[model samples]
Target: MDNYRFILSGGGTGGHIYPAIAIANELKERFPDAEILFVGAKDRMEMEKVPQAGYKIEGLWISGVQRKLTPKNLMFPLKVISSLVRSASILNKFKPHAVIGTGGFASGPLLKVASVKGIPCLIQEQNSYAGITNKLLADKVKKICVAYEGMDKFFPKDKIVKTGNPVRSDLISLSENRDNAMQFFNLDMDKPTLLVLGGSLGARRINELIEDKLSFFKTFGLQLIWQCGKLYYEEYKKYDSEEVKVYPFINRMDFAYTATDMIISRSGAGAVSELSIVGKPVIFIPSPNVAEDHQTKNAKALVAENAAVMIAERDLDTEFEEDFTDLMLTKNRQQELSDNIKRMSLPDATKRIVDEIEKMLGKG
Candidate 1:
């Protein structure tokens, strides 16, 4: 067990990809001699990102089936067959001690193949709702690590472990980075600041809402750190000035979290986990377009706990101003939210997940 081999598979979005990378990082740290390989769908972000994180990865010729009938949908069976063949070949060559899946289309084929080969397998489900791929792999997986409660509906109760999502290590501590954050964003520390996040690619509705509410935010003397995403950065960068800073992406999220007093964000599982660790008062506007409206479900879980505020995308136009105003004006409510959300954070999630992997490999 001194020189173990593990395969980490998942990726379509950062929500799936980062957790896999986080787990890989921990395994590397604890087992320096371990061989880690990532498997993801070809042409997806993981193909690029996993390598950037310093891991070798193999790409499967697979993608998710679309809802409507299309050429891509028609080719789904062929893609699955191809992916299975590739996955089987990979497992045969790599012969990993355990295979870890974080849930995306690529993981479906790989984990399915791994489990069938009788290799030890574990999957991390990052959402309140289990994804189609993870659901399909549930019966076969040795253990299911989940971020939310009540996931037994999708997974077997006997196999479930409520280990929170793996968040990036840099986000765990933000207090000491405040001065650097303030200087980095070039915002006055005396003024209250709001951080707006619209997920990785950016949300059009969120960008529009910010544009419409800029004058209102100015009235409250609120400064802004807006991450409009690369797709919309050009369109929104004109608003950047003394009071507002615009970024296509914030490379240093630790700084961004440390500097902000409050956040307005999409409630993707990754964002929810990171914000909880950041411990800032947040107004979650969950994306309506995702599968199963899971973003809303994820936000509602926190809202039910009084840990965060959630405003559906459909309700944003009608309720955002009042909700935003109420939270901003109530100092005690803000403190309550910050405290509650912080309580929801699982700072050791990455370690906990790796612990599961170790147990699967009999190295626990």
Candidate 2:
């Protein structure tokens, strides 16, 4: 009996869930006989997403602590205690050979328990600024896999491995049939296409900026493929027309990347990784709502190296039109960003992460 169990934990958002699944899928490919269990916070998107990915999952009664006063926060301590207990029970029953966390509230408790059991654990920090959960669990975990540099300030220098964030495999190697992608999107091949993405749930500021400036997009003879995200679809769909295709979600990211000449998007770690691989000229609008303003930091790292352009969310009202128009007109600037960002890409992140996992388990 191989009896080697692997426990993968992360939730709350696609950034955390997808990476955990990517790592789990890679592990299963290498060790088909190993048992795998996913642990996520109850009622989060992961409870649904993980199962859909063909993995068994358990949900912890855990929630993030509120930064401000709220009635719901009254149960924070209780939830934490219950989650810790549940995590220990799950670890006892599963008896995992190793545990992996990709930065989420549920991962904190689950990996903490795994660490206490003397099991080998790996933490994947996807952002330029470390997430609170991963930061808290840094010392406890045996290995820290990260996507950005200068992370020694967040985790132990010895434990850090600069494995770039894992993106969907297809995204790394885009199937370069641009004509086919254009046909699929019903877009003109001659016009420069702009792809605007606000992630799975959407960004309010980005959506508003696009709606406000949509009329201006036509002036440049540019076509638009907009992912408005599910949250803002109803409000933004009214603006969609023949030249502007508005989608709430895009499952075929490879096609999306291929069909576009330029991209306007939030600077989430996952989006940044995918963009680096696609090597398109990008205008980043980092969300202000994230913890520690990590998205801005992620964008700044790229901008510092001339890899991309960033417009702070608050500055969008004043600078978006000018910045966007300048980029569209300047072919030299676009090519420069494309070339520099491609230099920062790590398309084999999934392989690197899996290799580390295998090494930690002494199976390499």
Candidate 3:
């Protein structure tokens, strides 16, 4: 009974992929002999990341349907059919005890096939707003684990569990990492540090805003640990200096979090979840291009509770400086935001999710 087999399917973005990995890690820790597999879209970040995490992964020939009438849209049906067939074959071979989905196009076909085959299935929805894929699979899955309340609006009331999002284990305890983090990032302990995260792929608007305000930030004697993302690294590398350390991607987020005093980031669910644990003062500039403006809704939820600050992309030009200055200059305000956000952190989220998995599999 301890030797459970599970398939974790989700990808397309780090928000979805990292949660799956965290869950997989927790499962491995609990059942050391468990056989875990990952299913993700071919050519996506998960294909690379999952392997890097020391797990086997199979890639589906799949991608999300584009909003516009493009050639890829024409191939959507074909892709879906192909993914379903492959999923069925994989399930037949693995005969997993259960399947867990995070949220992405790849998870849709795999979870559907697994559920139809009578395998117990569960899904974790990281965002406050439900994703289209999770919404479609809600009725089929046995349990829906979610980070935010009011998810009953999208899922069956009886099946929903508020377990929060699964953040990486390394991020759970950062209080002891400040000195090591500062040394690793070559940051001065005397001056305040600002961490800039634009999610996994970098935000063009956020990057532009940072580039524009470099001098203004320097005026306050603030040092920066800027993660401009891989795509924009070349364009922004010229700005890297002693006071500003520019990275294409931050591999050591634990260090990044521990070294920084404040953060300016995209309000993607994964970022929001991780930031809560880091417990730093944050100004969320949610990405507007996402589906249904989910990022804005995520940021607003925290702002409503006075857990964080938010400035929309449209209002950045006029409001960003004033907002950033106020947050930076006020110590009491920073501590208040930090305290409130930390109170919102579910540091045991990964374990709770794994507990749900154990119960579903009758292994608890």
Each model's lDDT comes to: 0.93, 0.92, 0.93
Error of 1 at 335 (Å): 0.9
Candidate 2: where is the Cα deviation over 4 Å?
1-3
Where does candidate 2 have its weakest 10-residue lDDT segment?
1-10
- Pairs of residues at least 3 apart in sequence or in different chains that clash in candidate 3: none
Backbone collisions counted per model:
0, 0, 0
Candidate 1: tens digits of C-alpha lDDT, residues 301-320: 99999999998878988999
What TM-score goes with each of the models? 0.98, 0.97, 0.96
Model 2: lDDT of residue 219:
89
Which candidate leads in lDDT? 3
Q: lDDT per residue, candidate 3, 256-326, as tens digits?
A: 98899999999999899999998999999999999879999999999988999999999999999999999
The full ranking of all candidates by lDDT, starting with the best, is 3, 1, 2
Candidate 3 residue spans exceeding 4 A from truth: 175-177
